[model samples]
Target: MKYDWILFDADETLFHFDAFRGMQVMFKRFGIDFTEKQYADYQLVNKPLWVDYQDGKISAEQLKVTRFQGWADKLNVTPKALNSAFLEAMADICTLLPGASELIEALTGQAKLGIITNGFTELQQIRLDRTGMSDYFEYVVISEEVGVAKPDGGIFAHAHQLMGNPCKSTVLMVGDNPHSDVLGGMNFGIDTCWLNTQAAQRPEGIAPSYEVSSLQQLQRILLA
Candidate 1:
């Protein structure tokens, strides 16, 4: 492997983050059928909140509560309660992305593994535990706990310190989001691999060190 340490973004990179499915499961407890239309409507409010969160305009708590506000109003429940239910539902349905486990297992003895995710703290560990991936990582840096999200160098810096201040050249950051994962890693002076599963165009001025369509490809690249 070219790097001594490999940092991953948790959600879509390692785990399947089916938010719509999670919401449907969550709302069932309240006797509501979460339809596709409703999920589309939900994303209208949720997506921008995530952007604001990564931009440091809002805190993770604010993003969590605010995204559920409309549903809370409809259900006559507190937003905090709804958010908790959503996280619990997500954890219950959590599964590793295809090839994620194999890649991690293959890299176990080759490089130190860590996670630097902008995802919430409440769900990360539980999902890792459920999927039996808890022991693979040496560090799990959650933005919610770190007080800064990805795309900000602060979270990566925090991860670096936790990683015992390893040489920047010996680190690789891999993620599904170009802006948060690739650009952030580049800005922080580390190599990055963009997992462009959707075949999205690379944004101008934000080139990653490598790009691949699947975890299988990434694993090959790393172990080549």
Candidate 2:
């Protein structure tokens, strides 16, 4: 095999996390109105909590409770309601990204595939299973489970280890984020492919080995 393994990032790459839908449902059940502004605010707070949790500064459970608690405190809402609401929202809303299943199937058996992501392990698993993507990957490494997030290099190293330490030149890391996925892969000497759906330019001083606007573009690279 030219490429021994193919790694993917889950969030925006595999599926569109319907975060607003879940949040809305949770808020409605609690008789609370969730505004767009509030949703954005909470995400800002939650993102860092997750990063901290991934980096070993806090536990996964702590990250979840703290994000809800922090948002409830900021909005003067009951934390009890926030907890149940968050879970309810998470369960009700999960949308697979366009062509996600097709993409997975296309790469299946052509090269070993896996997911390297930073998110709740259970939630991500639910996504893969629900979307019928679990069968495509031999490995799925979540930062929360792996004790490190991307951009830190450790998580990338752990993921590589899980792939039996394939030669860096024979691995392809694909994801949406430049700072995390692309940078992490580059740091480990693996070729990185940036999935820039929005036409964003590569960050200065950090260039990916390949860049494509959509997952479909990968077809050409693999076939070549």
Candidate 3:
């Protein structure tokens, strides 16, 4: 392996995060149909919160509770309760991305693997365990626990500390988001690979060491 430590983002990098489907599953308990339009509306509330969370403008607790406040009001439940239930619903529907298993299998034992995700603490381990990917990662860092999100050097610093302060040049950070994953790693003085699965246009001033369309491709390049 080229890297001594390989770090990954959880959602969308290794796992498929279907928030709309998860919302439908969550609202089913309340007898809500949770239409597509409702999901679109929910994204209006959720997306900005994620930006704010990554920007250090909001706490993860605030983002979680605020996003569910409207639903909690309608259902006569606490926002925290709704958030927990939503996480459970998400866990119930979680699955690894295509070739995520193979990529991890190929990388494991060759390099120390770790996860650095902006996702909630409640859902991370459950998804790993459910997908049988728990043992492959030596560290699973959560933004909620770290009090900082990616694109911020603090979270990367925390991860490096957990990794026993490995040589930054020999560490590779891989994720789908160019901003959070690529930019963060670059700013933290580590190499990064952008998992451009959606084929989205790369944003200005954000460059990655490598780019690939899928985990299968990433595995091939890393193990080449």
Best by lDDT: 1
**Which clashing pairs does model 2 show?**
none
Collision count of model 3: 0
- Which regions of candidate 3 are displaced past 4 Å? none
TM-scores for all candidates: the values are: 0.99, 0.86, 0.99
Report the Cα lDDT for candidate 3.
Answer: 0.94
TM-score of 1: 0.99
lDDT, candidate 3, 85-143, per-residue tens: 99999999999999999999998788999999999999999999999988889999999
Considering only N, C-alpha and C atoms within 3 Å, which residue pairs clash in candidate 1? Answer: none
TM-score of 3: 0.99
For each candidate in the order shown, give its overall lDDT on alpha carbons.
Answer: 0.96, 0.79, 0.94
- Cα RMSD of all models vs. native, in order, equals 0.7, 2.8, 0.7
Off by over 4 Å in 1: none
Tens digits of per-residue lDDT for model 1, 1-224: 78999999999999999999999999999998889999999899999999999999999999989998988998899999999999999999999999999999999999999999999889999999999999999999999999999999999999999999999999999999999999999999999999999999999988899999999999999999
Candidate 2 segments exceeding 4 Å error: 47-62, 72-88
Q: For candidate 2, lDDT tens digit of each residue in 1-224? A: 46878899988888776777788888777677889998898888888876676456876667767778876786687665676566546756777767677777877888999899876675777777777777888998887777778867888888888788877899999999897889888888889989899998778977898898887887677757
